[model samples]
Each structure stands twice: as C-alpha cells, then as structure tokens.
Target: MSLKQSPCKDEIIAEAKRLGFYKIGFAKVRSVEKASASQYADWISVGCHGEMSYLDRYHDVRNNPQQLLPSAKTIIVCAASYYPAKKQSIELPQIATYALGRDYHEVLRERLMLLADFVGGETRVCVDTAPLRERYWAVQAGVGFVGRNSQLIIPDAGSYFFLGEILTSIEFPADTPLTQSCLECGRCVDSCPGNAIIGNGAIDARRCLSYLTIEYKGDFPEGFSLGNRLYGCDECQAVCPHNSTPIFTSIPDFEPSDELLSLDKKTISELTPELFSMIFRHSAIKRTKLMGLLRNLKALD
Candidate 1:
C-alpha cells in the first residue's frame, strides 16, 4: 500500500529520530541497475572479497531486493552515529569505533523491530550481517552519498556511522536521491595505508585494514602488519577530513565501556577463549572470534 494509506512519512521520520537513529529515508525496492551490478561483479571477479565466501551466497538476493523478499515494497534506511566522544588511549589495543560499544547488529536489529512495530506491517530488518548491499539502498533512500572511500557519507555525520534497513510491504515517501559527489578529492586513495580504496567509490576489500582485522582468518599477507589495530581498523575514517568535527552519540548503548576502551596488549594477550567470550560477549568483536583477535594481535608484533 502507498504510505498515504498507512503511516504519514513525517511520523515515521519522527519515530526514527526518537528511536536514536541519526537519519532515515525510504526507497522503492528494486534490482541493482547496470552500473552497480557490473561494479559488484568486477569487485568479486578480482577476488577482492578475500576469504568471505558468504559474500557470494544468495547471488540473486544480493543484487535485487525483490528476490530477497518478494513482497518487499520499500526499503527504510537508517543511520546511527558511532563516533565516540573520546578517543581511546594511543597505547591501547585498538578496536573500530563501531565495535567499542554493543554489537550494532543487536542494537540496530532491536531498533528496526521497534520501527516495524510502529509502522505495523510485514517487515524484515537487515543489518550488516545480511547479504544485501546496504550502502546501495542507503543511496537509493537518499540518506547519503557514497564517498571515494566507498563509505556512505551522511551530510552532517560523516562516514562514522552504521547503516541498517527495513524491508516492508508498505511504501513510503522517498527523498530525491542526493546528487552530491566526492570533490574528486583523492584524499581517501592517498590516505589508505594498504592501498585498499581504488577509484572513486570502489574498494578492494582484500587490501582493506577493516577486512584484514575482522574477516581475514589466516596469517597476515607478507609485508602487511596490523599496526596498532587488534580487532578492527578505522585509519581511513580517522583521516577523512569530513570526519573532523566528530558527531557525538547520546545513545547510552553506543557509548564505549571503560573496560573495552582501556584494554591493553597484556590483557588481550592473556585472554583465553572463555575470557574473550566474557569480554566481547555482546560486542561485534565476537564476529572475529578469540582466535581471530589473537591472530590480529600477533600481526601487530
């Protein structure tokens, strides 16, 4: 049904803000067009996905929302700022800002469920863990523009945010997709220490530090070191000029716990599986598992 027949768009946006999302937008569910489809195929063909075989799973659904859920009529895209008010100690083992707090999969999933309830319709939520191309939908929803770094850069909040989506049978008013493009500023390309980010809005995931820390399971590639990162890396975001004025999150759940922010190499090195489980029980770091963390820490040395 059309949004006019259901909840008003303004009310939906207001509920999103009240639910702690930084921004929200809607888009019609459709297939990935020629440009996007070709780019995705090229990225995968070059083996940039690394050992993440799942990226190839559900080929149809990954490229088309209709294939994911046939009744899906619209995509409700949401963003949550994870920029921390305080930076972690330089000497401490580093975790990506997104993982400093509770797992976003949990936080966003719960919030999306609430949003679905508010909209009162058949709905499904897809966090990063899903096979869907979230940034593509975010762009279609007019929530943000893709940056040269291949990140969804929301106008005011920069790229330091997590994106989530709700696939529902109800359609909503959609904003005109943003026309802004990166200033042809090659800053992200020059700043990538691993030479991961390629041309504008394209990334070689195999060379990305974030992927290396979180998804790569075996030994570090020759000449590649973890630097100070132990779980996930944020060097690209750290250097982005757009992220200079960091947006602080007021959501209590997004705040980094003191223990996690203060974890030292000694503490991380001494961690057993059980200890790791306890420490990251509710954190996204669990995606890498204890062994992955240990592998990352050893690479740093």
Candidate 2:
C-alpha cells in the first residue's frame, strides 16, 4: 500500500474510539527527538535502568523507528484506561491497577491489530516490551505529556492507562505536540516510598518499587522495602491529584478479578506453582512469575 495524500486523522481517530481507545495521536516515523534520546543515554549511563539491560541493548532501534520497520512512515499511538471503579482490600497485598485483569499486552495488541487493519497498510504492533520509547512518541503524537513521575499523563484519564502503537507505512500529518505539562505538584515525589522519582521525569529503576517487584529477576535489594505490594506498585500515580477523579475503564478486559481483589498474605503465601500458573495465566501479574511474587511476598512479610 502506498501513502495517501489526504489526512485520515479524523477517520482513524473515530475508528480507534469505536475500538475503545481513550486517547489517540499520530507522529511521522523518524529518529527520536534528540532531547529524548540524550536523556535516555544519560539515564542508562548513570545505571538508572538497573538490571534491565534490554533498554540499553536496543538503543539504536529504539532511537530510530526506521530500524524496526524499514517501510514505516507513521506511528499511531493509543492509550486505554485500566483503572477499575472498585478498590481492593486495603489490608491485602496490593497489586497495580493495570495488572488487575487480562494482560494489557494481549488486550491492547488485539485492538491495535484491528486498528492496523482499519488503516489498511503494512504495519507493526508495539506494546510495552517492544524496545520502542512509546511514551516519547506518545508525547510527540500529542497524546499526553510525560509527568514528573515519568508516566504519560493523559488529561482526565490520569496515568493509570496502557499504551500501544501501530507503526504503519501509511503517512498522515503529524499531530501537534501538546503544550501542557504537569503543575510540578511534587505530590508524586513526596508520596514515593522508594524515592524512585529522581526529578525531571527520570526514574532510578533500581529504587522503583514497580521495577523491583516485576522486572528485577533477583531477590529484593538490601535497604529496599517491598511494603505490601506483591506484583507492581502504583504509589506515584495514586498520589497524583490528577488521578483523584480517575476515569474508570469501560473495557471489561481491564476489570479486576475476584481473586486479585481478595488476595491476602495467607493466600499469596499458599500459592503453589500449579495454582499460580492457573490463576495468573492471562494476567500481567504472570510477568513476575511465581518465584518473583513469592519473593515479594516474603520480603513484605
């Protein structure tokens, strides 16, 4: 398929909404903006990425979308709220809202593939793991601004959303980047139990509770407390005043499960490998694996 001269922005956005995406934006595929690239290099150089060596391993491909899709000409970014209307027990082991239901990678990928088909083009799909700096392009696409806590904060949607993109060969006029930024509320900073927010939208993943819970492959590092979190952490987003009126997701795939909302220390401690595999079969919590969840539970205990 060849690039069309007309802007399909409205049509594409309409389809995305029909598909349940809450936010949508577009950007021409090109090298990542120099400022974002530089900041990433600095973050990695200072070892802020911690054991997530994959962030450094794919530096070139991540900086330039052309490397991932040689024929790609545009990026269609979309985000969906995962915030649930119901809250889990305060005393139970807490899980991130994003992980409460079906795995976003599965849910978002299916929707993105449908969106890609709607665009009628040669394309590639990306979720969180795909080496692409999604939040960076998401900002360029005008979906939202990078908050001080390093989350892509969409207006009204808050930061409790999942982002996915379809890299397409079809070209479209790029959306103007958003001029808005957070009010520098410092609430997220003051609220962080791990002090992971190192300011200026940068995070020391080594100290990030979310990173430590789900991404770190080893035991909890010395001096880091797991608190009550068993899978991922949402302290930064939870404290943001913008999230006070969080728009709950209508997507049933993002709803929390009964087991997740009722998970207590005893339940978690009793999880065997077999039961863990069965219960978390399609949950993002599977990313932590049984061992990692057990590790976090033990640390919190």
Candidate 3:
C-alpha cells in the first residue's frame, strides 16, 4: 500500500540524510515473497551458498520478519554508500570498496542507532550479519531494485552502498517499490571472472569471486585464478553502466586509511598477525582473518 508519506517520513529522511545515509525508505513487515524466498532456497539446495551454511541454518528466520522481531511493524532500510573518494592503486592487491574503511557493522550501527533513538521506539538493528534478505527489503522500502550483480542498485546512486535495517514496533506508511530494473546490458555477467553473476539477479556463490575470497573458507580448485585480488572482488559492479558516476560516500568512516592505501604485493607478503590485527582491527577485512587472507594471497601467486 502506497500511503502518502507524512511529516514523520520527511523528518526521518532529513535526519537519516543528515547522518550520512544515502537513502532511507520504509517498508511494512510481511513474509518474504514466495518466489524470492523459493529462489533463495533453490540457490542453497544446489549448494550455491558454498560454505555459508548459515543461510540454511536460519532458513525460517531469514524468510520471515516476525521471527526476528515479533512486534516489528515497520522496517527502516538505510543505505550507506562506501564508494571511496579515492581508490587504491591498481598495482596493489585489491580490496572491495566497502572494506576500504572501518568495519561497516560498527560504522552503520553507531549511526543507525542514532536514527533509532530519534524515531523513539522499541527497535532492533540488523546489519549484514542478520538473517534478513536485506536487498529485498531495500526494494520493498523503495530504496532501489536489485541489480544483475545481485547488489542493490539505487538509481543514479550506484551499488557501492551498504544496507542496514531497523525493525520498529512503530508503524510508518510503507513506500512503493521502484518499477525500474538495471539496463539490459550484460556487461556485469560477462565481466565476472568466475561467471558468478548468473544474470537473473541470482549469484552462484560457489563460482563467485567475492564468495570464494571472503566467505568460503575452503581451498580453491586446482588451476583456479585468484587474479590480483587480496580479499574480495568487484568485477561485476565495476563494469556496470550504473556505476559510471558513483555517488561517492559522504561517510568519513568509509575513507581508506593510509595503511590500506599502501597495501600491495610487498605488504601482503609481509602480512604478519601483528600487522593484520593492528591494521584491520576495525576493518571488515578481519572477516577472513590473517590465515584466510594469506591463503587467498598464495592462490593469487
């Protein structure tokens, strides 16, 4: 239902924008669409989720909002662009734009909590770790539609944004979904080094470079190509036409540190646990840990 947004929404949009969130939209809580939920089940059924067995473990909660917060009537989906003002040199092992700065969990959570306090309701906050289908809610909240790369593409804003949610006991008028889809160009599909962007807005994590490098904890197959990647890959998003003029993130926490900028082959070879702990103490790069990162670096060689 497209209820006309009242002053409350205007206030929310204003406060959220002031907090450096690129987009904020509201959605009424509902069961995930069967088609979408089924599609996810299919992805897992075929072992497409790879080693992230948590998707299977939390199947029910992931598909239902009520399971997460029984009193949640409205979902506030906020998008934070991590598109860097400056990027690392191509000579270095590449980290994804989202990981260039502080861990998003800490950054977005701290900011979103401020927003929640402003809204003033019994609420729960969820970032990437939560079982919710975040991109789906992004669409539901009218923030954006899912792109061919399986990333949420906010029209004219690009897909370099991270999504976080606030489930509230208070109900707000829900926004409508955007009727647009990505340009039909198949560049993202063709650009995938592992052919992971399956073109139907579904990703085959087993063949996804991001998944292999960051999520999957296993060794690569023989003759696999890790390319120049250090942690995660962004082959598809980089090639998308929508990302040509990125809405560079305004969040200061997203800016790359001098140490992250200096990362290269030499630095990677010298990646000591001490160095790793010190550098990535608050970085998302900690997800893979030093050993996993070393494994990926070795595969690249």
Candidate 4:
C-alpha cells in the first residue's frame, strides 16, 4: 500500500467505522505518564501480573509506543464491542463475554491492516500481542475511560469492546481525551467474585478469576473459589452501570455460536478434547485449551 504522509483524521475515522469498529480516535505518540509507569512497575514488582511473565518482560517498550514502531507520529486507536446479541442463560456455567466470539486478535488485526492500507503509511498493527499499554492509549485517544474494573469503558457502549491500535509515521490531528471518569460507584469492586479488584483500575491477577482461569497454569490454589466460572468471570462488568444498557455490537464475527450458547454444566463436564477443539477452533477461549477448561470446571463441583 502507498504511504500517506499526511493522513486525514476524518478519513481514518470514517474508514474505521466502515470496518465494523464502533469508536476510533487518533493520538500523538508519546511516553506514558510517569505515575502510570511507576504504578505498573510497582504492580510488577509486587507480582500482580501473577503467572503472566510476559507482562514482566516489557517495561520500556510498553512505556514507549515509538519503540514498537519507529518514528510513529500518530496512534490510531479503535474499539470493537463484542457484546453478544444472544447471551447464555444464567443457569449455564460462565465464560467471559469477550471470549465468546472468534479470536479478536485475528479479527481486529485483519481489519486494522485494511484500515492501515487506506491511510497508507509505515504502520504497525497492535491487537493485544504488543507490549504497548492499550487501555491507556484508548483513553488518550478519547475512545473511552478506564473503569475501576480495569476495562476501558466506552460511553453507552460499555466495556465489552476489544481495542486495537495503528502506530504510523503519518501525523494527524490528535483528539481530546474524555475528561470524565467512571462514576466511582464501587459496584465493580464490590461485585468481583474473587475480590481481585483493587481500587484505581488495578487488579490482583493472582486472585483474579480471569487470570486464574486463563493465565495460571498449575492446579487451583488452596482455599480458592471459582464461583461457577467455567472459563472466565464477568461479575464486575455485569454490575457496572455503564454496561446496564450496553450498546450491543453490530459485528457478526463477534456473535456467539450455537455450540457456545448451548454450553451448560452437563456439556462442559462431558466435553471431550475433540468437542473442545471443534467448539473453540476459532475462539479466544482456545487459549485455555482443553485441560485448562476442564480443570476450571473442577472448581464448580
């Protein structure tokens, strides 16, 4: 694709919306705030990332987006909501909302690449793999605010969105970040089944059900409780006021499969490896693999 030296922000926004992204904004590349950097350092130092050692490895690169893409003058951030049109009945074992659909990494990256081509520049697409702090940039680009649940909350759309970024050499006018923050209602903090949520968007991943179910590798910890979380938990987001009347996503790729919606305690406990692979062949839930998911079901007993 040809390089656009001065990509128009309006054109970029239009292209992003056309590509199934719900919200998009542009920001100038810069180092994250000192306080943010320090807090991350402290979080890592205290082993808040738990078994996710990758978070421990990328400090400088995460703090500096330019390191991921040299001379990256503008960062284009986009949010794609994954709120399913059909939700599972409350009687079923729970999977996190985000992993209910196709793997967002592939979906977002393919779309971002096309958007990049439209802008035409030396661009690098980041959709959850890179070390960059995505939620921070999402906030910086005015796409949303980071809620206490540690998820980026889009106004009226809730926090069920996946974020992707384009770091390009092309400079564009930066958008103003939303000045507001979450209502500090403490609903997410109180509703956390594992009590993993600390104040100020920080999570103790060691105790976080999402981390335990998806990231942790060993046997379930002693005295730990899973609370019917077969794969991941959504207690916090479920209680957040921002998500009460969520602006559901329009993307077909994010819709839940019948196989997924049909999952219940009986099916999960009887799942064979073949059935597991078939159901989650293209899902983000594949990250947990068969054993991991089966292991999580053990805690449901």
Q: Of the candidates shown, which would achieve the greatest lDDT relative to the real structure?
A: 3
Per-residue lDDT, model 1, residue 99, is 88
| Per-residue lDDT of 151 in model 3 | 86
Which stretches in model 1 have alpha-carbon errors above 4 Å?
A: 1-5, 221-223
State the displacement of the C-alpha of residue 188, model 1, in Å, after optimal TM-score superposition.
Answer: 1.8
Each prediction's Cα lDDT score?
0.83, 0.87, 0.89, 0.88
Each candidate structure's count of clashing pairs: 0, 0, 0, 1
Model 1, 1-301: lDDT tens per residue?
5464467778888998898888898999888877888888888888988888898788788888877678888889989888767668988878888888888888889998998878766788889877899988888889989988888888867898889988898777777778787555677788787899887588888888888889887787666687888877777777777787877775678888888887988888899999889989999999899888888888885
How big is the RMSD of model 2?
Answer: 2.0
**C-alpha TM-scores of all predictions:** 0.95, 0.95, 0.95, 0.95
Q: What is the lDDT of candidate 2?
A: 0.87
Show where candidate 3 strays beyond 4 Å: 1-7
Clashing pairs for predicted structure model 2, backbone only: none
Residue pairs clashing, model 3:
none
lDDT of 4 by residue, 14-67 (tens): 888899999998899999999999988999999889989999887889999999
Question: What clash count does candidate 1 reach?
Answer: 0
For residues 40-146, what per-residue lDDT tens digits would candidate 3 score against the true structure?
88888988888888888888899888789999999999998998888999878889888998999999999999988887667889998889999999999999998
Q: Please, what are the lDDT tens digits per residue for candidate 2 over residues 67-159?
A: 888999999999988887777887888888888889999999999998888886678999887889999898889999989999999976688
lDDT (C-alpha) at residue 203 in model 4: 96
In candidate 4, which residue pairs clash?
4-120
